[model samples]
Target: MDLSNIPKPIWYALTAFLLLTIGYGAANHVPGLNSSDKESAENKASTVPNSSSVKVSVFDEATQAPVVGAKVIVESQGGSDTDTTDNLGAFRVQIPTTDYVKVRISKNYCEPYNQDLNLKSNPDRPKPIFLKCSVPQKKYMPSS
Candidate 1:
């Protein structure tokens, strides 16, 4: 390709236009990149007033004891909220009233739990989750 015929100003203008086009495309298509922090916060605030508070309690399936320090993540189209269970093995989160949410619970010592919740159709309190995990075993070796 020969570029000697093209003027420097035209080349600079073409480069600027290409950059602007790419930036606009990325800002529109990429998630979380299009909106400013304040705008995103405002959007969340507008939806939160109509949200419902969902409480989740975790327990061990074997012993039925409360599972403490478990991590709970609730996700929906709006966003996601994460919390850790306290000594009572319970955590609460606010989710939009009309969206379906995916709830995930995890603990190092117990099996992970996942459930899909329909907040609009159900409109009822969620059920508690119980995790079942196998007991860890130790290995023994003969001394040399």
Candidate 2:
């Protein structure tokens, strides 16, 4: 590790590279930073019609109550979009006007709901989707 003869410019370049590497690694690990960046990039890269929108609402199957803070993902041939439901348990995501798109809705303690929708046939309005709670059943023990 004899660096006494190393040039100042080379040392500076190496230091800069190391700093950049550390900064990038730190940024990637920050909560919500990576996903937000990717989502923004995907949105900018999308070439779909801006007029088309998909409205997804999550509801509890048993109680028929709105499930807030649900994660909604819509995927099409163009790209994928992610959103979270509001207090009304609704997420309106702008999507490309395509023939078909896959929609997935998930929430903690609830079973994920997935469906392939025909956007062309469906009306240009928000659709309500229901999700059932995934309550684990207990096993019955036999008497000894």
Candidate 3:
């Protein structure tokens, strides 16, 4: 290979092509440098697994009726999930797989209920929460 005889422009073009090939290869093949769209998608999927749709239903304990507008809070290792009861007094939430979680239910004029539930065994089952409700005594007036 005699470099003294070769033209300068031709050498520069060849050098540029070689550098580009190496840079592209490194960007696609290197571990940390090769963060493509596919790798990011896989990372997102691997972050959470074994998630289940846990159905939660809130009801009035005294009347045994559905309690609308009730707040349902589920605390787990991943994070806390909260939702208000709909017209059917039910809502579905995604709970990541864990040993146990704290479930809290609260509504107006009702005693808040708190409990720890283990949903690992059966995660798809509907959990019914009963909130004790109370009514204030009515006052009477006598006129002479």
* Per-candidate TM-score against the hidden true structure: 0.57, 0.58, 0.58
Task: Arrange candidates by lDDT, descending.
Answer: 2, 3, 1
lDDT of each: 0.75, 0.77, 0.76
Separately for all candidates shown, the number of backbone clashes (residues 3 or more apart, or on different chains) is 0, 0, 0
Predicted structure 2, TM vs. truth? 0.58
lDDT by residue (1-144, candidate 3, tens digit) is 768888999989999999999999778644467756564432332335776566888888888888899888887787566778989889666667677889988887899889997776766777887888987677887877
Where is model 3 more than 4 Å wrong at Cα? Answer: 1-49, 136-144
Local accuracy of candidate 1 as per-residue lDDT tens digits, 2-117: 98899999999999999999999888644477765554532352347667777777888998888899889888776677878979888777666656779899988687889886
Best by lDDT: 2
lDDT comparing candidate 2 with the true structure: 0.77
Clashing pairs in 3: none
Worst lDDT 10-window in candidate 3 = 39-48
Clash pairs, model 2 backbone: none
Residue 69 lDDT (model 3): 91
**Which digits, one per residue and each the tens of the lDDT, describe model 2 over residues 1-144?**
899789999999999999999988877644455655444453542435554777777888888888989888998887778878989888776666677889998888898888997777556676778899765687999999
